[model samples]
Target: MLTQTRNVEEKLYFNRFVVDAGRPHITVRPHERPSAELRSLTHMCPAGCYSQNEAGQVEIATDGCLECGTCRIVTARTGEVEWNYPRGGFGILYKFG
Candidate 1:
């Protein structure tokens, strides 16, 4: 049997995201800006949904989120993030295993 191999980006292309406008499932607390946990999210998130703003504050855009819960785990004890599942039918849809 011939198997196909795909890179991370390529595999990710098979996934689809349904964004919930005006109702982001994940948000960075403004009061928690510039924290070590938030900073770590910038690089730790597999979907790259977290980033550092010009003012050195962490920000989140939930559109392309893989919903892997990395952010939640990283900031769970810090109270620096708000994490939840998107509304039903709005979130990542994995096309392949």
Candidate 2:
């Protein structure tokens, strides 16, 4: 049998929502994605999605995620990570979402 692997062992030095990818060639990598351009996005997650991660940073994810610069540009700079995006062609297929 073949051995396993490590995909995205660390998202940030802290505040990790995903970890231990447990398989080689599984197509995983740390992605610092660009923020969305949808202007409708406004409020941050008051429910605390960031606290759920390994670290206590939660300014990202798909809740009321406004696609504004809430999580990526600003939150990332302050080091209060709380986000993850769906794989391309997957997750919420928003025709108008």
Candidate 3:
């Protein structure tokens, strides 16, 4: 048996993302401004989709989202995030088992 290890970035390269134009499955609610909960997403999102702007505001770009549900899980009770699964055939397609 042979064993191989790859870092997250390297492993991600084998996956494909089918993004739905003008339709994002995850978004930061408009009324939810920057806060501890929002800021926490910047560190918690494994895909690095959340970031802090110069004005100390949290923003999200769903282009490379892994669709892992981390954001939803973290803010499930806050209503700060609106999350749904992308339309059929428009999301992550894992190439590796």
For residue 74, give model 2's deviation from the true position in Å: 2.5
Estimated TM-score per prediction? 0.91, 0.28, 0.85
Model 1 quality (TM-score)? 0.91
Q: Per-residue lDDT tens digits of candidate 1, residues 1-97?
A: 9999999889999999998899999998886356788799989998888888788888899989998888999898887999999999999999876
Where is model 3 poorest over a 10-residue stretch in terms of lDDT? Answer: 29-38
Tell me the spans in candidate 2 whose CA falls farther than 4 Å from its real position: 1-69, 82-84
Q: Write the per-residue lDDT of candidate 3 for residues 2-77, one digit (tens) a residue.
A: 9998987889999888889999888887643666777899999988899988877677889878888888888877
- Winner on lDDT (1 vs 2): 1
Regarding lDDT, does 2 or 3 come out ahead? 3
4-90 in candidate 2: lDDT tens per residue? 543432321222122223321111123343233211122343322232224322223343222333444544443333445544433
Best model number under lDDT = 1
Candidate 2 collision pairs: 15-55, 41-66, 50-58, 57-81, 58-82, 59-82, 60-82
Candidate 3's C-alpha lDDT?
Answer: 0.84
